[model samples]
Target: MINKIVQNMAEAMAGVKDGMTVLLGGFGLVGQPNNLVDALIETGVKDLTVVANNAGGGTTGLTALMEHGRVRKLVCSFPRSNNTIFEELYRAGKIELEIVPQGTMAERIRAAGAGVGAFFTPTGVGTKMAEGKEVREFNGRKMVMEYALPGDIALVEAWEADRWGNLTFKLSGRNFNPVMATAAKTTIVQTQHIVELGALDPQHIMCPGLYVDRVIHIPYGDPPF
Candidate 1:
């Protein structure tokens, strides 16, 4: 009876603390764990460093955390979205922002999960993004060194999950969830459907149970935005 299922968001977020780096799985608004995000905000944990694809849209989800001044820093590929919270905070010297190139950011998270020390890529060479970083020649092409990015906790959403924690995602919703799952110390899932132990097809499982620590069921619908 190795059930990873948790009763509610509070239990799933129990071990999270202040001043931690959290990985949020989503590409814009899709694939985000809205309930978990809301729970984290409710916990009132301040000084968090959140890593995500974008700031957020509107005044909910990740933006709610920013609006409350809970996030001290944001490490994301894009800060601009339908919402202007991130931009306002950055300009007012209220929040820190680190803009990683999209592909480079994904690879960095993957490298962390794969136990890689560091990697070199030509993604941001000869730009301000490459400043103060190691650069070397690989096949006469310059590559900038990027380090692995790991998180204290990761919150991801899934289309379906089982008691064993195997997860499947819908199309574009699968974007950063899988990689973020493996790169965090604790991976918590907010799933739309919870099935029996053997319900998930082996081939369809995008994120296996070993990488997941907790799963909470939050049915898919019009989530609070």
Candidate 2:
């Protein structure tokens, strides 16, 4: 097996550049890849398009990117109550925003990874969310078709991973990481623990090694939250 480990978050994020679309894996504040987020902030890459369920509560998750004024667009399902930076940017027209329903967001990413161009869902039928979108009838119900969202890079958090890159997430953090892995051109993983090859059970691996391009193990003493 090829070893996918990297020395640090900076090395893992080496290829990220300006004006790139990045998919961030996490639900709320639960399983965000903090180390990678810090490194990206430090890299100072600009004009980023971030896709996530929500921006971190404050200056925590993707909010860090917003603080740097690096984010040009956000394709997210919802904005957290404390995400003042995002709200301000949106209000000021400093950033472009595309709001999607929570369930539709997940399906969009999954469809992208599966190489599907578009799929229909009934989640937003008859609502403002359905405006300008392609609509189709399925089993007597109206459904809107949404296109897949593929990103240039995907930043994800994993609870544990092997040297070969088999990854697993803890609890709620597993929300979007797995799907985002396959939808991005490059997938960078920040993990709480790293183990030798064969350390993790095959059945427990939520994301296989082939989908992962790099892995960084956060230091044991480092604060995750």
Number of the top-ranking candidate, with lDDT as the measure: 1
Residue 53 Cα positional deviation in candidate 2, in Å, after optimal superposition: 0.8
Error of 1 at 49 (Å): 0.5
CA lDDT of each prediction against the hidden true structure: 0.92, 0.86
Model 2, 1-225: lDDT tens digits are: 488999966789888899999999988667788668889988889999999988666466688788789999999988764658888888899999889998889889989999999999999999999999999999999899899999999999898998888899887779899999999999999898998788888888899988999999884443346
